[model samples]
Target: MALVLAAQRGRCCLWALRRQRWNQVQRFVKWASTIGGHNIGKILIANRGEIACRVMRTAKKMGVKSVAVYSEADRNSMHVAMADEAYCIGPAPSQQSYLAMEKIMQVAKVSAAQAIHPGYGFLSENTEFAELCKQEGIIFIGPPSSAIRDMGIKSTSKAIMSAAGVPVVEGYHGEDQSDECLKEHAKRIGYPVMIKAVRGGGGKGMRIAHSEKEFLDQLESARREAKKSFNDDAVLIEKFVDNPRHVEVQVFGDQHGNAVYLFERDCSVQRRHQKIIEEAPGPGINPEVRRRLGEAAVKAAKAVNYVGAGTVEFIMDSKHNFYFMEMNTRLQVEHPVTEMITGTDLVEWQLRVAAGEKIPLMQEDIVLQGHAFEARIYAEDPNNNFMPGAGPLLHLTTPPPDSFTRIETGVRQGDEVSVHYDPMIAKLVVWAEDRQAALRKLRYSLHQYNIVGLSTNIDFLLSLSGHPQFEAGNVHTNFIPQHHDELFPTKKATPHEVMCQAALGLILKEKMLTDAFRDQSDDKFSPFASSTGRRINICYTRKLSLLDGENIVDVAVSYNQEGSYKMQIQDETFLISGEIFNEGDSVYLRSSVNGTVCKSKLVILDNTIYLFFPEGSAQIGLPVPKYLSAVSSVVMQSGAVAPMTGTVEKVFVKAGDKVKIGDPLMVMIAMKMEHTIRAPKAGVIKKVNFQEGAQANRHAPLVEFVDEEAESK
Candidate 1:
């Protein structure tokens, strides 16, 4: 009893000390502000989507009026609905709306906004915009314009960090664009070097040069992308940090020359340099390393007299050595994880700090509580190379009983997933006592998440969360590509599982027939009679299996409504609705099988289904009957097409242009990656549908692939 009392006293003492330290930091931050009261009023948010909604939530909590500026495409957006007042800025394209400095400023003035909060993207990092706000006497709820300017250029930021005694990856940030110069730098830094654009972000204008041959090809590609993206052909070469963990520290500063770090977040789980999953209190970082990282981040922030919220990103090697990468002088997409663990509303802090209020907490007062994880749910198809998917979102439902896990979504059911901007559908965040617990929560939440009418990467995220290495907290930069086969294994289900599914389908079909008969007549029919009667017809189809065998199964299905279907085999009947496929054709099922019933989750390829069985799991291809067509136009047209997912850097043929076989049609840019579309056969461009800057969907026609030769002949 005495020992327990002592332990409790010790914990109380620690809590008091933490509070005391926070008070000191707060005192220092608010030394000047204490003379005045908190007076920040109306704030204009210059962005769209969930981020705008997220900032508005904090503003409402602080009793501050938030005015949202939206584009024509976002007039019905959730952010616009959440704001105290909303106004239209421009058309759908980002440049004319969210990125328009004059329009945003004009809206702020008209709305009587005293402060402007640029959330994450768009004009968030535009130093010119920040300076304009400062000149207009409007508080920019972000870092100083000078800080943004200094960090906007990768070369200058690296120089700044290096001067501040922060380790930086050895590279050539010089302005020389000669191939010889780049080759020499690459050789000196080693073969596996990364080429990047100085004025670009979001993984754009970046390429990995592994060998001599790859160097030349990547150099040209990088230049082309840089020229098109930032209108700057200058590139920087840096040594690739092999097997590195991407970790960043969130820091805040005040005009009183005081700053504090909020620990670190692990953002190594990325796709094409864009983080997909992030977690607070980085998985493998220990206390000592955390302290060093935090101090370094604070020093970097202090070097530029940074005010407001900013993040200092670093790449840590296997040996725990880290190098400063870049600083993002804006609120990050993954800031919710930090908020969950620290109990601090960063947007509120930004407002308070911008109002000349000091940070009320000291570094020592900032206590690391539990672990938190964030997953970016995007309207993208992971199986289709992470292409941006677009269509009317028929359904957008999140996991129920939002406990420690929180969902932040901008679009609801009936909303359109347009190709006008980023494909981030929502952000799902979960918190727990530790990393493993957080992972478990995240996995469960992902499993329960459902988004229909458009493809998404939810299943991929679930698989990544459940990955052995990821759960073990041992993943690095190349984790995805290294384990691609294992992560997305290609295997066929056992014959017995197939038989069980068939049996279940049969049973379901019999039940449906009996139900229909009973509904039509007063008398009920037995299950045995229905199964034995010639009234029921079974269809069989043969498909190639992954295991070098053939799969044959009987498909029995019925329609509950237009475009909605239910398939039955034996005792198991799978309920499938939304976007129906070919009539009476065998379709692959990707589902989680429980006992005699298999739940259809994600439909993989047209013919492949991921199935969860009672005993184990398997992938089974549904057999298409011999009477059915090998290729069904119904199934092909039913699938959602990718639009504006890729960067259309160039459109070779214009409308009514004469062309030949396999001529380059257009290009699509996505996730900073580029893909080229070509003509199918010899033909004249009947109609060039898309323009250079206009984005295209997967099935959206780029150009008519008519056979010109055939027409001539």
Candidate 2:
């Protein structure tokens, strides 16, 4: 009866899916009318990666064609495959490719695309790009150039917000950018002020000086990053609201001068000042507060005659007193959370509004439905301050998508997460009836997202979402730092049972492969050809060494004649039996350890065994022999080393220069952020390994340090 009911339910789901697709087609047909009196048949996506794929998905659903402009590096990217037309503009560096406006415009002209969608990041909020689209007679599927200009500059946006009756943070948004003047203003505003570049967004060129002593250093760092990212280093000082919640309203405007907000998203949990997870219809907000947030956001939009999708960011205190932080004049990275609760396709709205149509739904017509969460999964080692990483996605598996779950991504399994772009692998989004349910769903979905290759933040995100404070929705920008101990608990050794399971998996996999080889060879059906470790009237023991991080564990497996085995780890021993099976595209291991049966997904790649159980995952490495390990390890002289792959932007010390501990050695730009390499100990610089604009791999020494005594000798 249960099987019958499940079959019926499956049919019902299929029917629902068919209906949804049909409805989408009907909606597209309706919107297929002329845009701005000219049929917008094709749109040129002026971006790359996930956002580009996101725009193309909507364009395809709307029955419109999409043209993708990619760098040479992205010639075979997923977005290129998805687009109706694709063109290679230039090489990998964004300045010559994705950010090259003239190349994109020429593609637009050549492709005869009626519009361009700057899908977040590069050229998304570029005022000049928006204006250039106008000059080229192409509809930029975003806000007006004037609006982008007004909001692109933090100082200008603050003045406009203040004039428009929006509560603005108290700070200096003045013309005097002198270090001394900014310092005086920071002193006036008080310590713990935010030093932000005027054109900063996505946490770039933003810093917090907790006290007056570090104000100048923080300011200079922010200026350098600002200059690198925006080509403008002018900064604005704002009172950094301690323990504030980052809430932002999603507002949309049309050429008809009508606008509305889609409530708010609380991006309070952040690292390096960028949002890690986002949820919509902010956790503790009341209906009254929600209405006011929406109204204020709409007012800000109308103030600049904004069009298309825009996010108005606010810094809210415990008392719910909100102050304008800044405005992102393009679609936000976390926009899907807003869409989940509001049941709106914002990209479609962007396309429609850009075509000179009114917003499909007004303020009263829009209703917030359920709670949603978006957790950004990046290629980074969370234990190492979340420093970004780049490599191949050797194996990737995500939870099945449904009505309430989404995996927004651009790269696929076996694709490289390049060093030249943001390290985000995908955005895992989930929705449920309420906040707690949504939180639970988010955790469950995260557990199913399995990846094998370089380091990832998946385990860290799991730890974060399951934290007591985060589960209760009591989130703030400093939540991670405040709960560091709980979030980053001391490492524990791998459980004996898990290690046993890892050994069994390895044993079973090897036996299977050996059996396959024997079956294909002339030794087929030969008793001696079996590698099952079975000997006549004798038990064979095989010892294996596995590396867990830096520590190694030795496992002894004693094979029994009856196909079962006894595995010993340290002093613990367990009888284990397992058979590996190939299911669909995944490898599964059904193992009985001490008569406790369990199943786990197994993936072996790059000398590491990855075991994904229902609850969690484990990684066990096959230790390389000492001789090979020594040969592969690159030894470097005592010096400052790069934390990740990036370009050396500036070198502060020359060869033979004396430096104290913690002195700046050089600056590197990587994964769209700036990192300063500081001296490890007092020494004289023997040699500089890289100059400005030279690429450096992770852990590569930037400077060779010599001892003071040796230099004196």
Candidate 3:
């Protein structure tokens, strides 16, 4: 049956091709009527950040003047600087600027733009916005508003697919809101169902409920989150396919009723329901399945009269049965991989299609050239719950883009990674002949990339790329959390390594002091040493190393100015710049075993020298005649602190709020993102030092928690 359907579709496609060829004169006339041979003169972009910049790059290449709309916070953003003209839409919050349709339209009018390109997020998928563009007599460089409306709603899109004979995941997409109703639906569908917001993207307002209790509990939370994030609380329940591979087909269409599929991309590697990595030519998709997937996607696109470029996403189970997911109506972050494989510029096609031109390529012309992968490098700490890191990027560097690798970014050194935007620093993509080669190139690019003064997940990405299982391509959706222990081993530096570091620190200090004395010794004399032969004193202390197998090591060094020195271990001699001092108050020591060298700060207090290594202070008795006492005091403390450097989103606690354990005291929205901070324990909030829209540094205290004493019975 499938083969028969394929044959019919192929025949239809060929007939359409013949008709298109025969009607070239009529097609030319239609094209002239729509575009009038006038290329886009000016384009207004209704988005911000890297995506906006990405669109402008293509716009400029096509000789189109680009206009950028930005909020006050993004005045100096790269996108603003890249545009031929820029206008301030509103303040920092997106509600006033990016999502403000009136303001965006005003900018378009003021800029005299011939078209409006709603780059990815913001209002890209908003059917009303697209409709407004048409009403204003400006080209909307995307799918038709009708197509957007058709695919904008999950339930409606699934129904449309069902009508088109496309396979869809079994679930309930009705308007039922009752807990019992959803619970019944979950049971009918089976356990382990996915609750997703109908209007949500980017993994927001999605939850996985395993049982009846969980379904009820997660439903309200998902609704609330969906409302807050996307202003829509309506959700749909779908059957969760275990170990499913996320795949999507890129499709393009024109006004002449022609559409073509550009193969598929695998975006299965994800965290928190958001994709962190994506690749082209999915790892395990056989040739037969690939052909079917492409055909289905083409049918899906044709069902909606889709124009311009769009994506049809799917979830394929282990048995190779694929189910239709959602369709993205705009350009995707992972489009670079598809470009790498097909050598097609989707942005260019979007412009050409919007201008009423036919798709420039046919099915046979589209061919997968090689494997490609893209890793989204984010300003977040992988070691600390992936909390978004926001601060001024003090330094940024990466290798140049070549045939094998590409780096797409909108930031540079001295740029502020503000909390009002996504924390994605850049997208690192690599292309090679095969999957293994692509993975290797990705790992190399990640290692070579460097960003300072802000935490990033570069190290974590490198580790994941190089992991045995990941390299072998034998991973599932739950791979990260499942094998986190093995991938992220909890191994601290060995005692010998610490000792070696300490020795190196000492050597560096000695060299610095020696250089300082050589440059300015004539200006000032040392207080511990006279001009002749008086002794100098040094004191230093460092942290003790605790390693595996109960191994511990402490490093402390002290010296006096006199030429005579006392050694604790007579067999070991401290190497100080190739000089051996038999008797001296100032003695330099380097651990020969570990290659650690140190300069000591010797103090002649009660004939004892003190050693410090930025960790702690230690006292050493000089002259070999006194007993030694080593005491260590280490301090450990914790409280309400910012997990990462980000702008304060909201502070819920005040000077004296009684709070129970697990109560949310504050909410932080960073990198144009959001997170909640809960109470560590049952306590009274002593003080709240931050407010909404304030900058908070990493580890800075935002509130004080005073523990409540047990009441007397």
Candidate 4:
């Protein structure tokens, strides 16, 4: 009994001593920052994309030199150019480059940087990487390694929240991860349970099993995704919530047990469990509920001794009851909206705090300024179920910057949206006096934004902004599904006026090329000068095709002298005249039709033309003549072909393996999403053309199938 008392006394003394030291450090930082900016001499950013660029801007403002590390694919990225010094860490694939801990550390040491800032994704929340920085005596511009470990694992975080008196849904988080154990838990939780991988983020490795019959299959899929994404397949089961809003509170803490909440953000607008749009001061939340949420968040942060910026997420029911979900111990993607409303630069605070600075403002000093919204712009086709897209940015434009508008992007007009990284192009943030005004600005900005060569969700975004239900703030996790028809209206046939604009675009492109050639030649007059119109009185026909759903409409164009053309569709004909003007990376085409002059922004990419106006856009294609189409057999339905350019990840069947309808053939991964190719019909796999880990072209054959009759013979 005496020994036990003595040991307890010793432990109390050690805790008191450590607490004293932490308080001293906190006091020093708070004093130093107010007098002058905390000086971090130099820092290296160990990530890529817009978030990396965002950190560098703040670092420069703080008088700190910045270093950048990039994969071979990102060698020419904007972040690399923005940094004072840059280095290529490894090859294009992320594992060999951006996620290579040793390479990132080596660059930091070589550049003599005093700290490393991991921008959101890649290695931002990796506790092992944070520990490596501590061992090297280099500061990590994020929460401490201890905090990362505690909050990164979903099971551990839930347990900690429960101990702190925070409400958490029933979930099985255990050491025994056998399939049998998980099955038993699912049965207890009842049907429609949520199976989530404990070590995963970004909505990966999460699945919903609605019945016992489908539980095992979904569990296996979730495990595979988890293992491939996070290198950990352990999972936890929880009761799924219906009609829940994803609300999260921002919190900050220091070494001296000082913590404050920075209001809340409504991230209920999501797809694939990833946020698409986010707003500050979550809609419909009252003062009392907000206060309770803030208190809960602060408590959660203090439980982990969290330092730096973090978000404590919750799932709120329709009646305003909220439950703790998990904590993200790093910067979040939708942070810009928070900054807009709070009038604070979260990135700047991160830099100062990492350099031993403290929170500059107390709880009373922080106030919400106005309403703000952030819309993520992605290269995807809304018509194709929002599948990710990759291509060159043949044409690009964005809303002009102002006090109420902010455009955050890491790629330029001519850059390529590679298949190896996220397809997000930019974040469009708007601020205003109220929600209605902010939404109006969001709609205007969406109309102003434009892209070519690949499809984007700009039109869909505009539709969503004008949605009557959305305008009334009727939002939830399942909002999109409930309003799918209104958000994505059916595509209609192209108008004749639009086809005329496309013809004008093609003519303008030819004229520019000819003019360029003439200027490069020594002789002022070249024989290949741009043709003004069809030769004298002769008329020539050109065919134009526009894609709508699964079919194509062909329109005929007849050219006459002096920039005149006639577009005809079976029984209808429209005589059109247009003039085009070129401006900084954009072309404006003015078309005169039906005694009205309509102007449109034009973009011509190879054989395609895009016309952007006030309402939306139209894609026009220069179709090949029927004679050439017959000779060039570009599409083969019988052969398993890649839908986009990517690296093949797996082949389930080998040469001569028999396959039936809907059987798995291969897995093709691109832009960080996986697509499995299935056999279309019963047949024998005559040839597995490409091996695993091989590069594939768009629509290139992967496996060739011989007819069953031919195989039998």
Per lDDT, the best of the predicted structures is 2
How many backbone collisions does model 2 have?
0
Runs off by more than 4 Å, candidate 2: 1-29, 33-37, 525-528, 535-539, 635-637, 707-713
Sort the candidates on TM-score, descending order.
2, 4, 1, 3
Model 3 earns a TM-score of: 0.77
lDDT of 2 at 541: 88
Candidate 2 residue pairs in backbone clash: none
Residue 199 deviation, candidate 3, in Å? 1.0
Residue by residue across 1-713, what tens digits does model 2's lDDT show? Answer: 99798667656644554554456557667767654355677999999889999999988877789999999988889999999999999999999999999999999999999999998999999999999999988989999999999999999999999999999999999999999999999999998999999999999999999999999989999999999999999999999999999999999999998999999999999999999999998998999999999899999999999999999999999999999999999999999998887778999999888887899788887777768999999999889889899999899999999988999999999889888899999999998767887899999999889999889999999999999888888999999999999999999888889889999998888888887888788956665557878645545887889988789999999988889999898888899988898987899999998999999999988789999988899999998888899887776557778888899999899998989999999999998988888888888889999999999998788899886568779
lDDT of 3 by residue, 1-713 (tens): 99798667656644544454345435444543445365577889898877888888877766678999999998998999999999999998788889999999988998899888898888999999999989998999999998898898888999999999989999999987777888899999998999998887878788899887778767876786677677888899999998788889999989999999999998887887888888898887889999999999999999999998899999988787899999888888899899877766687678778877789788997767668999999988777778777788754667668855788888877898877778888899888767877887887677557565667887778777878877877656766887788767784544333333343433344445665675676645554223222235523322223222233344333332442222222234342222322223233333233234443322223333333332222333323222432222111133477776666766778866888878878877555456678887776776787898788876778787654443221
Provide the clashing-pair count of each candidate structure. Answer: 33, 0, 36, 0
- Summarize candidate 4's per-residue lDDT along 1-713 as a digit string, tens digits: 99798667656644543454355447545554552444477889998989889888877765678999999999899999999999999999899999999999999999998889998878999999999999999989999998999898999999999999999988798878998999999899887888998987888789889999999978987887788778899899988888689999999887667889999999887777777888988888999999999999999999999988999999999988999888988999999888777667787777767767677567897777557899999998878777788889877899898866999889888899988899999999998756887898998888889887678878877887788987887778877877888887777777766766776677667877877887887875545664554444444777766543335666687776766777776677878777788766677888876557888888777667788887777887766577987887767766688878787777899987888889989877788776678887788888888888898988898889986567678
On residues 588-668, what C-alpha lDDT tens digit does candidate 1 reach at each position? 233223334344333233444543332333455555565675544332221122345554677777756666655666666
Model 1: how far is 275 from its true place, Å?
Answer: 0.8
Whole-model lDDT, model 4 = 0.83
lDDT of 2: 0.90
